[model samples]
Target: MLVFAFQISRSGKSTYLQQVCLVVILAQIGCYVPARFATIRVVDRIFTRMGTMDNLESNSSTFMTEMRETAFIMQNVTNRSLIVMDELGRATSSSDGLAMAWSCCEYLLSLKAYTVFATHMDSLAELAT
Candidate 1:
């Protein structure tokens, strides 16, 4: 099944993609896995993005928070999971980010899970061809 939640004003693709990942993860928890003896693993490589937490007090820096969030995404992903990732290294230099994004795309292509990657890296678009 597919689930999408997006708006015309903003880039809602990522949000909808995340929803698909969540659904896939949940579905895998029950009949899907037990029937096929399969597992769900998701891996993400998002660029700079805010954490779900909303804190007014002092805390980690932006860079620290980004790293932590990325780590969390990766740790939570499973093989049978659907990965919804944004630009991988967008917070860093362009070249660095492109390279990171390229590698991530390659990694996902290697995996058997469904992936929805959102990025502005047209260079990597060649992968689709």
Candidate 2:
């Protein structure tokens, strides 16, 4: 199932993602996840080991760094993989960023991967229809 969560910062959006990621990882490893009587079934390998770009002191432009990380994810993701992408393509111009974001979503759709993409780009919701 594709789930879209929209909320302001400091409203537990990131916390929610962290919880979900933890549960999925635990489930993948055959560990018990306490879910308040709800069963969480994870059927694929979780890829949550990726590092954030926030601490990296890269000489490359922000857009370039974003694209590099994005490309890495695209190369490694599978149909059953769960991807959590936060604020994708945010470093470029609005038009370029939106286009890149739209294209990335399109490619992810083609793969049928379960993705949780958090973004301020409201137009991206239109891609689902």
Candidate 3:
């Protein structure tokens, strides 16, 4: 499943992504998830931050950090992985960011992985078509 969720900050977009991540992690660990009924198969998963890299040392600019993390995900993610990316390419100019974001989306699609991307960039919706 490839899903794109578009919403403003604090409008539950991040919350929703976090919830999905939590559920998937719990399922992978053989723990109980709070969902009423979920049949999630065990799968590897990854999440990309909206602005910062968590727990990683990086003196680079935010855009560079974001790209680095993205490259990591692209390199490691597999067809069975579930990827949840929040606000991809947000640290750069709109044109450059959108182009990179679009390219990433295309690459992920080609991998046939399940992906959930949350973004404020409406232009990215075109990828669905």
Candidate 4:
């Protein structure tokens, strides 16, 4: 889902996305979640793409590294997979990034995986409609 609130810019959305994935992980590991009404869907795998992730030692730019990771996710993720991508398309020019994000969103929607995508591009929220 596209988070629309401007106040969530302080990494709150990223944190929130992490919590959801963590809950599923905790549940899968047999840890009892203290929820009065919980129906956590069982998933095969969890993939995450944190925006600032980079492999500096390998001489890979953050954008290149993230692109490789994103490609891997698209290739490996399944309907039962859980995906959390934060600030996709932010490593390049704004227009380029938004274009990439837009296409990625379309692809992710087609896959029907449980996905949580967080971005600072407010225009992306329009895609929800």
Best by TM-score: 3
Off by over 4 Å in 2: 37-45, 48-58
Per residue, candidate 2 scores C-alpha lDDT tens digits across 38-83 of 5665546554422345435667766677788888888888888887
Q: Compared with the true structure, what per-residue lDDT tens digits does model 4 show for residues 16-112?
A: 7888888899898889886877888899999988866568888898899989988999899888888888888878899999999888887877777
Model 1 ranges with Cα > 4 A deviation = 1-9, 25-64, 67-78
User: What lDDT score belongs to each candidate, Candidate 1 first?
Assistant: 0.54, 0.72, 0.83, 0.80
Between which residue pairs do clashes occur in model 2? none
Q: Which is superior by TM-score, 2 or 4?
A: 4
Q: Among these predicted structures, which one has the highest lDDT?
A: 3
Could you tell me which residue pairs clash in candidate 3?
Answer: none
User: Which of candidates 1 and 4 is the stronger one according to lDDT?
Assistant: 4
| True-structure RMSD for candidate 2 | 2.7
Candidate 3, residues 37-121, lDDT tens digits: the string is: 9898667666555546443465577777888889899889888888888888888899888898899889989988888899888
lDDT string for model 1 (1-129, tens) is 111122343567666555555555565454343235535443342222332342336476544554566676556654555556655565668898788667656665665445566666667767766
Clash count for each candidate, listed in order shown: 9, 0, 0, 0
